[model samples]
Target chain A: DAMVIQNPRYQVTQFGKPVTLSCSQTLNHNVMYWYQQKSSQAPKLLFHYYDKDFNNEADTPDNFQSRRPNTSFCFLDIRSPGLGDAAMYLCATSTRESMSTDTQYFGPGTRLTVL
Target chain B: AQSVAQPEDQVNVAEGNPLTVKCTYSVSGNPYLFWYVQYPNRGLQFLLKYITGDNLVKGSYGFEAEFNKSQTSFHLKKPSALVSDSALYFCARGIKAAGNKLTFGGGTRVLVKP
Candidate 1:
């Protein structure tokens, strides 16, 4: 099935260490997004790429960065991992046609644990 | 400020009983609405959406949602609850002015007792 996939479902990293989370999609959607979801809270948008044009959320921290090397692959880079940053990171994809109405498909998510 | 609201933190329902998850949004213009379901340790799965036309929208896994313009609400419904249906549900909205992002509700956990 054409779906989104994330690597290393669970990740463990030390404080201040840099870690990368990967996401790839078979759906070939034009838009890819990264979101941080804390415990018992709604998933917060971090950044997204609309066909190589990166759009970052205003409130997103500097430690968080993302890169879409190609249409099928996107990576989230944590420059400095913090205990508070340990949460499920989700990647989603959608089409560019009508952003307000298009449905986003999501991956299983990568759960990051800070040590 | 634009926001999506899911009033209930959790909803408990007996198996075979009807289930309802309430959601309300405050936004400008006509916004697109969506419902997503998340199982434990999994990403959200799209359930349904409301763009225009039908007020009542049916979706996967026997789920349906009603869009009420006056109330600014889109509530999800299931005629018969199942034990397997227990999960976290989130309501989201996409406003054209907000760019390419969906503002999600706080989420509502549903527990269907068998």
Candidate 2:
């Protein structure tokens, strides 16, 4: 099936260490997004890539960065992992159009644990 | 600020009974609303959306939602709830100016007792 896929369903990293989560999509969607979802909280948008243009959320922390090396692959890099950064990282893809409602498809998500 | 709100933190329903999940939104201009479901340890699955046209929109898994512009509400509904329907439900609104970014609600956990 054409779907979004995430690697390392569970990840463990030491505090202040760098970690990377990966995502890929077979849907060929033009837009890819990364979101941070804490336990019992709504998934918050961290950043997104519309083609090669990166759009970061205004309130996203500096420690969080993302790269879309290509259309099918995107990576989320945590410069320095913190306890607060331990959360489920979700990757989503969507086919965007001018002035249209686009439905985003999501991956299973990576559960990050900062020790 | 554009936002979506799920009033209830959790909803309990008996199997085979009607299920209703409430959602309200505060956004500028015409609202584009959506409903998504998330199972434990999994990503969210798109259920339904209302951009324009009919007030009632039917979606995956026998689920439907009614969009009320006057009430600024889009509530998800199911005629007969199933045990498998238990999960976290979220309400979201699309922000056109923000590259059609989705602003999601806090989410409501649905519990359908068999």
Candidate 3:
């Protein structure tokens, strides 16, 4: 099965410290996305990468950044983690053909706990 | 702007009974609806999606969703619920004409009694 994979399922970061969450996919989809899902809330889109082009959401803070060196691997970096930054970070991938159908496949999320 | 809504925060049903999870959406153009399920500490698994041609779309785990365009609703249904079906259900919608950001509902926690 071609599945999406994430590293460091559970992470604890000190306040003001930096943290990075990684995601890799076997599906080799054309687009990759990062989402932040807080407790009991819908996941919010932070950013995404279509092939090598990066697109950031409007409300996403500057503290967050994403890097996709290639198609298989994507990384999310949090410059300075705050208590409010504790949440589950999800990574997903999708593809668009001529018809432009978007169906995303999600990976197991990284749970970040900031103290 | 595209958005999705799950009216019920939680739903409870017996194991052998039918189950339904409600979802509604708002979008500029035609809507692409999707349903996802999440177990404890696990990633979300795609249950089903409604693109076109079919009002009742069957998906993984014996789950199906009906697209009601007039009511702007896409509710998930199962003929017979199972205990393993208990999980967090999320309704998501995307407008391809606009952008790719999938607007998701708050999510509904379903509990199937044994």
Candidate 4:
């Protein structure tokens, strides 16, 4: 079935170390988004890619970066992991042309633990 | 800007009883409302959405939501709550013309006791 998939459901990284979380989709949607969800909080949008164009949220930290190397794959790279950065990272996809009723499909999410 | 609000942090309901989760939204243009359910350690699953037309929209898992234009609310409802229905519920809003970015509510955890 067509669905979004994320690698390394749980990840552990040392403080200040670089880590990458991967997301791939079989749905072939035109838009891909990355969100950070802390415990007991709503998922916050970090960045998204409408095709090759990257759109970053205004409040997203500089340490967070993302790349959409191709239509099906997107990667979130943390330049320097911090304790506060430990949270569930979610990846979602949607077909933008269906803008009015577009529904985002999500992956299981990668849980990052910064030590 | 588009935003969604789930007033209750948690809701407790008895099995087989009716349940309602409150949601209010703010949007510049016509609102596209949606409801998603998340189980523990799992991704969010879409339950339903209201794009336009009817005020009542039925969706997966015997769930439904009523859209009130005047109240700026879209509350999730179920006739008979089930124990398996317990999970975190989220309300989200998106602008008609703002691409596909969604603004989600803080989420309300629902507990259905048997």
Per-model CA lDDT versus the true structure: 0.93, 0.93, 0.89, 0.92
Point out the higher-scoring one by lDDT: 2 or 4: 2
Q: Judged by lDDT relative to the true structure, which candidate is superior, 3 or 4? A: 4
Q: Model 4: per-residue lDDT, tens digit, A23-61?
A: 999999999999999995889999999999998889999
lDDT of 1 by residue, B1-114 (tens): 647899999999999999999999885766689999999999999999999998999999999999998999999999999999999999998867434688899999999998
TM-score of chain B of each: 0.94, 0.95, 0.92, 0.94
TM-score of each: 0.97, 0.97, 0.95, 0.96
- lDDT per residue as tens, model 3, B1-97: 4478999999999999999999988845677888999887777889999888979899999999999998999999999999999999999887563
Error of 3 at A1 (Å): 2.0
RMSD values for the candidates in order, in angstroms, are: 1.1, 1.2, 1.6, 1.4
lDDT of 1 by residue, A1-115 (tens): 9999999899999999999999999998999999999995799999899988998889999999998999999999999999999999999999968868989899999999999
Candidate 4 lDDT at B110 equals: 98
Tell me the docking grade of candidate 1: medium
On DockQ, the candidate that comes out on top is 1
Considering the two chains of model 4, state its CAPRI-style docking category: medium
Error of 1 at A20 (Å): 0.3
lDDT, residue B96, candidate 3: 61
Candidate 4 segments whose C-alpha is farther than 4 A from its true place: B96-99
Candidate 4 pairs with clashing backbones: none
Span of ten consecutive residues with least summed lDDT in model 2 chain B: B94-103
Kept native contacts, as fractions per model, are 0.63, 0.54, 0.40, 0.67
Q: lDDT at A23 for candidate 2?
A: 99
Model 3 RMSD vs true structure = 1.6
